[model samples]
Target chain A: MTGQEPPKNPHGDDGPNPPDTGMGMTAVAYLLSGMLVWGGIGWLVDHWVGTRGIFAGLGAVLGMAGGVYLIVRRLGA
Target chain B: MAVQSMVLADVPFPPSVEDFYLPSILPWGEHDNYWFTKITALVWLSAALIIIFFLVAYRKPQLVPSKRQWLAESLYGFVRNNIAIEMIGPAGVRFAPYLTTLFTFILLNNFWGIVPLIQISPNSHIAFPAFLAVISYVMFIWVGIRHHGFVKYFKNSLIPPAPWFILPLLIPIEFFSNFLVRPFSLAVRLFANMFAGHMLLLVFTLGGFAMLNANAWFLPFSIVSWAMTIALTFLEFLVICLQAYVFTVLTASYVQGALADEH
Candidate 1:
């Protein structure tokens, strides 16, 4: 049997009106923001820990987690 | 350059851990390139296999299908009905095919990492996951901007409805989290999990082999380690499927967010 599809909530309430924009702008924003944070995480880890690999890894994870939280809260709200 | 020279050139390129990674069937110079080289080949092979199998199985569509056809159909319907349409809504149904392909590709690639002979997953490589992440990132951004204008998409992404005073602190963080964090997290999550799982398997399996070199008494302990490796292999299989599902589901969710009016 095929998997069941979930019913959509028609009464869903979105918070506000979003601005209209082109795909390229958003894509560039996502890409550049991620790379910058990645670099920042690396720098922060190297400065604090004096060890690069593991701390950088943790920084990346934290940065990502922080990102996901913000996006979900923003969009979902 | 001749194939022989190229192969020979790689032979002396470096002598390290890679030299130890002799695949059960050396596809000539096939496995010589990079961490994700085998991954890419296997991913392509898996795609080809899936396509061929489906074509052959459903050559003449039937109400009561053969086993192969049933398996293929089940896989298709599972992703189509469960993930794509479910997350994205009826309007999103058209995306089922692409989403289904994506799910299966990631699933096969992730699972391939733990398979006996082909012991690497391309998704475990940062590049492949990064590529997928970028694709997803582009897609969602496209969809979001198409639904909302570019300016609106940006606002929806970061600027939650807030008092003017709150903008000073919240805007940059929101912007960074939404735009920068999404794809990076996506890539790292899959990469880290797969990489760590693989490293663990290597440790257990190799440790067992290394331990066996000890006196006969220590040889028995190696069996326990091997057993753990086997158990972890099963766990890895579960992880492969789970991670693939998570990635696909998240992608669907993001796409849905793009298509829908921002909340």
Candidate 2:
């Protein structure tokens, strides 16, 4: 749209690093899925233990941490 | 949504979601019959138009390129070079055809949402976008599998460069995000855009009618509503092109990711 080229580099076989279309999606997915998956697992654990959502809360925090780690490792430059 | 046209020749007030469904064309007044409807017809029509136009336009390849050929060539060239190649690089040349078809199909279908008489997009239906997402999902996974062996592809996508203790946390997140979320988000994004755009237009257009019918004093407000509908139609046009471009570029990006040898 800028009528100019996106910069390219010689890294992979494709030469051009993928543009910014789905990157936002992948970032969001990783963040949300990390929390939801861990949080849901913790919810199940809570159901089994009959505790009052404490485990779920802990899991959400842990999952959020995992999400941030994944985002940095995978998406961070 | 074919079942939404509960009664013919009568428009509903407030334009509930029921307005999305139009009466079946194949079996006239039968409420349950959804064999063929405006949505179905529009989809088929768009497909046919694209195929026929490309074929006719390029029936005779020319050195100078006729207007039809030029238009057809530019469309293909734009997607091939801009979207496919730009996103996926040189190897993306092989993928230009599919990307072009996807762009045109979605663009046409989304364009229908703003068309005067036919103000509904087939893409407003989740099934269409979901199906397209399925195709992209399958193709990317298949490409990944082929490029990297099945075991390796899974390793590449699911196992990021991380320490072993953190592996448990990271792997599940990777699988859930890459495998599960990609297709779901792809389908939902396009469907939601078209669905919301159509709903917005419907509210503006039908709200004018509902208002005018309720009170003559509401004429000016009704006129303003109609004006808003026109303005929103232009906004819908922008959304239509954007959603189409987004879908194609994302698909190409997925392919690029799938084919990447390293992070």
Candidate 3:
């Protein structure tokens, strides 16, 4: 052992991608919550507007896009 | 099939969720009583055991080592080094005590799921995990607010680095994901695992009896079912440890997220 002070948090490790950072769960959470929140909101909008499932479908797709965007922004960069 | 009906006469073929709601202890089957139960007893026992064990283990001071002291130290070191500091950075040292306590409490509680007669985890109930999750949730938020102040902390987490045009879309997503999902998932993940583990064991153990009770021809299959139950117990052991470790690591990760500067 070098007897030096241990490296700091996961980022301090030598590996390019540290493991078990809990970011994976965070990513999944973003994706799922994104779809649920926007889609549910769209469904309510549809209910009020008296439209069919079109808005809900659009919302799910848009939310999923936002989720990917968030993952890329937060975890990727 | 010639068999003594009284041996396992009341063995319900397919175990149900009712089995988990063990009868009350305080009132002794008086019905409409929920003050004390086996689950409550196990939880209290686990807490007391940890408190006493740690107190006694570190009570004696030795430079070289004693077995109990060494064991206690190892547990603390693992959580501090591997979980707290590893996940939360240098500032995590302050949280090692809480993380270690959490790890041991969950480990012991989950262990009860497969322990011979004490075959039910207090965590199988949603209330216990929900409360634990609340503590973690409140802690990270408090830490974040204390570190960055209330407004800045909310800005730090709720507002992502994105083009201003799309911020309206992104901010809601961030709030829902970070604030709402984190605690809900934390509680559900642990409770479901323990609950399902108990249910799985109950099914196999009772399936054996159910098969034997059905007909003599199924006796061999019943033996195999019991054998599978034994193997699954070992698997349960692995799950118990993994779930405990996962919970601690995630809580530390949340704290780290709270303390992060930019990214």
TM for every model, in the order presented, reads 0.72, 0.92, 0.95
Model 2: per-residue Cα lDDT over B134-246, one tens digit each: 99999999999998989999999999999899999878888888889899999999999999999898888778877766766898998999999999999999999999999
Q: Among all windows of ten consecutive residues in candidate 3 chain B, which has the lowest summed lDDT?
A: B1-10
What lDDT tens digits, residue by residue, belong to model 2 across residues A1-75? Answer: 123243354134535465474777778888899899899889999999999899899988888899999888877
* Model 2 chain A weakest 10-residue run by lDDT: A1-10
* lDDT tens per residue, model 1, B1-87: 577444433333222335334443334455554444455577678889778877897798778877887888888888776776666
Q: Taking chain A by itself, what TM-score does each prediction score?
A: 0.47, 0.76, 0.76
Model number with the top TM-score:
3
* Candidate 2 vs candidate 3, TM-score winner: 3
RMSD of each: 9.3, 4.3, 2.6
Which segments of candidate 1 are over 4 A away from where they belong? A2-77, B1-37
Per prediction, the TM-score for chain B is 0.84, 0.95, 0.97
lDDT of 2 at B111: 95
TM-score of chain B of 1: 0.84
- The TM-score between candidate 2 and the true structure equals 0.92
Interface RMSD of 2: 4.3
Clashes of each: 11, 1, 0
Error of 1 at B126 (Å): 1.4
Residue B81 of model 2 has an lDDT of: 73
lDDT by residue (B131-217, candidate 3, tens digit) is 999999999999999999999999999999989998988888999999999999999999999999999999999999888778868
Model 1 CAPRI rating: incorrect
| Candidate 1: Cα lDDT at B157 | 66
